[model samples]
Target: MRNVERFIGDKLQERKDNLSIRSLSTNIPPVDFCSNDYLGFARSGELKHMINSTLASMQNHLNGAGGSRLLSGNTRFTEETEAFIADFHQAESGLIFNSGYDANVGLLSSVPQRGDTIITDELIHASIIDGCRLSHATRFKFYHNNINDLESKLKLAKGNIFVVVESVYSMDGNIAPLLALSDLCERYKANLIVDEAHATGIFGANGRGLINQLNLTKQVFARIVTFGKALGVHGAIVLGSQNLRQYLINFARSFIYTTAAPIHNIVAVNCSYQYLSKIDHQLIHQKITLFRKALKENHIKTLSSESAIQGILFSSNEATKQAAANLQSKGFDVRAILSPTVALGKERLRICVHTYNTDEEIISLVNYLKELN
Candidate 1:
């Protein structure tokens, strides 16, 4: 008992020794190259005004949800938003969870029963990995985005199989081959689950996400969409069949036990989506294209990605951290993805482009990297 605190201190020291210790920073830099606010809606005064106006119309609006959805937390507004999201995403139903982490943890930990088999991309987000670890079913990882590797694993999988992937990977900013993966799922009789966190406000007709963007909504089994990224809000939703919604409501521990999001937060999410449905996707694509071109002109080697998430891999953690510091010194807020979070030799600086970013800023960012090297 006397030495219990030593273990915690030792782990902290390990992180420091490896240049992987993390700290939070509240300061937002002038140049915006490092936020998940791909649509710039997170800073939108329009969304704020809409949320306030919507809140004012509510009768006796409360500041807090007071209870979980299974208790006194559920409201008419919640049901309406869920239905709205389902219709927007072309899914049969939608269920809101506290966040992307909760949605993934809740679904993965509960949906796959004992004797089931779960297969996922090796580069899937950490939240999904944690969820898989918590599940009673067996889990396996395939090489990242390699269809051939996925099939090889699927061929040997037993019981009810679930295959998971991200429509837009958060680190590399590369998109999944949903059409190809969905086809594989069908060939193997595996359920395909997609995390559309980064694609929700930037892809598809009306930004419904990559699944609907590719006309593969019927091919995928489930999708997890989060508002905290492109939507510029908080919370997340699981888009699937009505049966899946019902099942999560009954069995998903994360959704069942947590206090529901406050009314104003829900109102904000709904307002953001209302704005998302009307925003110009073409204009956003123009920004993405512009940034990509800048990187190419500089001859800066980067991961092949058409999305807003872009990464420049460095050989070591120290090199990546120093590079990120150099960028931040010039007012770019790019972040370093150090080892353990990524593999040892795969350290990188993750740069996120937004619609609000000007051409000058994009050019400056790529040029800075070029000049630094």
Candidate 2:
């Protein structure tokens, strides 16, 4: 066999040995607990109707974006949506990207020039880490949520400094100390870039995100807001100054090269925001409270998180996988996170709670998890 084929075979065998060989699963679980659709917008018939009506009014009903935004993909409605997002998020301007990953890759890889330094939380999302790696900037990581360590690194950093962090961590589901981090950035004259992937549509008054909720929009340099999670659609936006938007247009390659998302997708995202504006977010908070209360009552020990993502650590990959399989057998979709995705000792059952999850479902899941523990 060819060397390339043999190398690929070896990697596949390694994954199988580790019990981490992943495959696509299209079957919807009986109990909803593992998806990122925290607000149920992805599953909403009302949102579908809104998208249909908006699309029907369009003069051009083309299925595709036609070309990249730099060429022919840019539309009046898309630009208007960007402006609306900027105004809603209290930013000076907004630029859309194909996905949250693209936004991070584009912004981080382009913004910080050579000789500039990037300081990030050790536990930031993989996209952020990839973006940082793509940049010409020198990068350093501090302990997760450790302000002192960040400051110490900041003192040692040279040239222009950009600090990147996720408002709510994707894996562990813990929130960063944004207020303090923003304060530190201000004191040290560093720009703060926050990826609100998990926080958007779950926090803030109108689901604007954690930055908006904390009133730190003015303090942050750039915010990457994704529609895939709580907003329940596709694509992401970088919110910042108009100059920053213009600069990214000139330099951010990911946004420049990719085919623009379809018109229907942008419409769906806009509709999700409109839907968010009218709904009562208190219902989501109540659900989170109830779920947390159940976990406590069942005496299930998991990572402390006020957000929708919660994780319970198990001793090994085998134990965590068995726990997840047991839950799956009982009609739950709870998934296990194993190394090298997480540290060896951090193998856990990552459970995501959503507004659509019923009270009975939450109780049953917690009781089963308690028994497993």
- In candidate 2, position 370 carries an lDDT of 84
Q: TM-score for all predictions?
A: 0.98, 0.98
lDDT (10s digit) by residue, model 1, range 1-373 = 3476888889999999999998898876788888899998989998889999999999899999999999999999999999999999989999999899999999999999889999999999988998999998988999999999999999888899999999999988899988889989999999999999999888888888889989998988899999999899999999999999999999999999999999999999999989986778887788888878887888888999888888899999999999999999999988899999989999999988888988888888888999866
Candidate 2's residue-wise lDDT over 1-373, tens digit each?
Answer: 9999999999999988987777788875688899899989999999889989998999766798989999989988899999999999999999999999999999999999899999999998899999999999999999999999999999998899999999999999999999999999999999999999999888898888899999999999999999999988999999999999999999999999989988998899888889998777888888888988998888888898989999999988889899998999999999989988898889999999988899899988888888887
Query: In model 1, which runs have C-alpha deviations exceeding 4 angstroms?
Result: none
Against the true structure, candidate 2 reaches a TM-score of 0.98
Candidate 2, backbone clash total: 0
RMSD of 1: 1.1
Candidate 2: list runs displaced more than 4 Å: none
lDDT, candidate 2, at 328: 93
